[model samples]
Target chain A: METLLSPVVLFFLLGAMATLIRSDLAIPETIGKAMSLYLMAAIGLKGGVEVSQAGFTPDLVLAALAGLALSFLLPVPVFFLLRSIGRLDGTNAAAVAAHYGSVSVVTFVTGVEVLTGRGMAPAGYMVAVLALMETPAIISGLLLASRSGGQALQARGKLLHETLANGSVVLLVGSFLIGLIAGKPGFEPIAPVFEGAFRGILCLFLLDMGLIAARRLRETRSLTPVLMVLAIVFALMNGLIGVLVGAGLGLDAGSVAALGVLAGSASYIAVPAAMRLALPQADPGLYLGMSLAVTFPFNILIGIPIYAAVAEMVAR
Target chain B: MTSRVANKTRLDILVDRPLLSVVTDILHDTRVTGHTVLPALEGEGAHGPWYEDQISGSQRKVMVICVAEPDTADRVLTLLQPLLDSHGIVVMTSQVGVVRGSKFA
Candidate 1:
């Protein structure tokens, strides 16, 4: 109950309600983009600082590899299931597959906040893990789509370019490297700006996100029951996989919950743009609504606690 | 003496998924050979910026560019009107010199 009433969750609910009520509220695009950059930089710098303190270990490497593997493999089952249940043709299933396979940075960031609020902190290297997990699922999703019916976009080279150069990937990886090089002393100068403003900015971004989600939900008339069930199941399975992997890696409860959030959250920013250019035939509403409207809210509001409890049990 | 040569007709169409095949079939039925479909990134219509990531099997806008004889364009537009009644499409015609009149018509 206390967790549910936290400022972060409350602000998110406020935003969601504001948007649903058709309030004239909005976060400026420029500010939103800047907030995104700030969050990435802050996470990277903090992670770098932690890495400096702890030193790089094999466990870090293993966790990263596991994250990559989950990102690559999770979508295959999702694609197949979507095919059977939704009766989605091959191309559409593959496009949707890519979405589930990828991690949502925003959700991961929210998890970090939830953990931090509870006075629990995850290892900094998780930032790099988050960065690494972004692209593999995309590749796998495209591959699955192509193999299913060979209707994959012919602009392979362009699609590769878009995936690699997507804004989120560049900002995330770049910030991680900056933190790696800058270390603690370097991060100190920018800490006041990046660290201090994070929560307020997150509130703003969540508000916009809420608006987008509400707008997406308006199109729910088109969603079938099968797709809805598939989305919920996939979200749950995704969270479960993250818990198992994080536990196997010997992560603590908070860290494990954060990881679960990462795995369960689908990419709305990066994957949607890539899909637009690559899989134009696939329905956007299905993928976007499932990720944004269904999975995102569920993770933020409910999945976090469930995962947190599961993490505690496993860690014990 | 040069009589007024028939103008070239341009057809632009934005359609959802299920209707894409039908639109293409219309073109095929008309024997209009060459057309290009461009992907729509974001836009506002009856629904706000149609987020492609939201709806199931929903349609994204595709810009289909076709150049044909005025008569053929007229026929195609006439055929497409009913289809576009429920959806969205734009049609326009302009006078232009065709390098090969026979090939175009």
Candidate 2:
């Protein structure tokens, strides 16, 4: 309840309600973009600082491997589920599955904040884990969509390039490295913008996110109820699986929660760009609606607490 | 003094940003010498409305404009029609007059 009532989540709720009730409130495009960049940089920098203090360890390696395996393997089940139970074609199923398999940075950030608010700090190396998990599902998705042979093979090179060059990946990884090099000395100069005002900026960003999500929900006419239910189911199952893996690997409580969040959260940014190039025939309405509209809001409101609890239980 | 003008076809294609390269490549292959691509701020279509600054490039739209001779325009249009049908793209062509026809070569 406390987590739900946090200022950030409240702002998100406010934005969502305003949109649902047809209010004219909106965050300007440039402002929203600036906030997004700020948040990504702040989180990356913090991660870098943490990593600098801790240095590379065997646990970090294990976490990265777990993230990669989760990213690459999760989609196979999702693809089959969508094909058989959801009754979607290969292209649409693969597209949706790719989304489920990849991580949502916003959700990851929010989960970290929630855990931190409770006095548990996740490992800084989790940021590297986040970056590593972005692309493999795209490869799996394309292969599934291609089946025998087609344009998929020819476009693989270009799609790989596009995926790597996505702005989100560049910003997160670049900011992390900058943070690593800058170390403790560098954090002082930028503390005013990146550290002091981090939460306020996140509030404003989530407000905008809420508005956009509500709009997307309205725009989604193509999703069936079965698929809708599966959105929640996928998050639950994937999140549990991720937490189990993290606990099994002997990670701390906070890092375990972060892992759960990453596994549960679907990609709305990087995967979508890759899919646009690799699976052009797939409907954006279905994948975007499921990821942005359904899964995003769910994780924000309900999934975070449950995952945190599960993480605590496993750590205990 | 009057400026010299010659007939040409102005091809405009609105496509998702990720596919802009593929569209431009088709123009290159179809013998279009020059083209300009502009980012679209916002618009509504079959997939509903979208904005350029939505923080996701997958659904963001870009407008590709090129002036070409009729033959080149026809070839580009024929090739892109299938893509337009499959993807969320809008393609249109209008007759226009260019100052120097050779410049579009």
* Model 1 lDDT tens row, A1-316: 7668977778778878887888988665456666667777777777777787778988688778888998999999999898888888897788788888898887888888887777666778888888888889889988897788746364577668877887777888887777778788888898888788888777777766676677677655546777877787888898888988889888766767777777887887778667755676666667877887778887888887777777778853
Q: List the residue pairs that clash in candidate 1.
A: A284-B52, A284-B53, A284-B54, A285-B54, A285-B55, A286-B54, A286-B55, A288-B53
Q: Best candidate per DockQ, number?
A: 2
- Given candidate 1, what's the lDDT at residue A136? 91
- Whole-structure CA lDDT of model 1: 0.75
lDDT of 2 at A124: 96
User: What TM value does model 1 have?
Assistant: 0.78
Error of 2 at A101 (Å): 1.1
Tens digit of per-residue lDDT, candidate 1, span B1-105: 245354577677776543455577778888886778876656776434663322222444566777787777778888988645443454555567555555665
CAPRI quality of model 1: incorrect
The stretch of ten residues in a row with the least summed lDDT in candidate 2 chain B is B47-56
RMSD in Å for all candidates: 6.6, 1.6
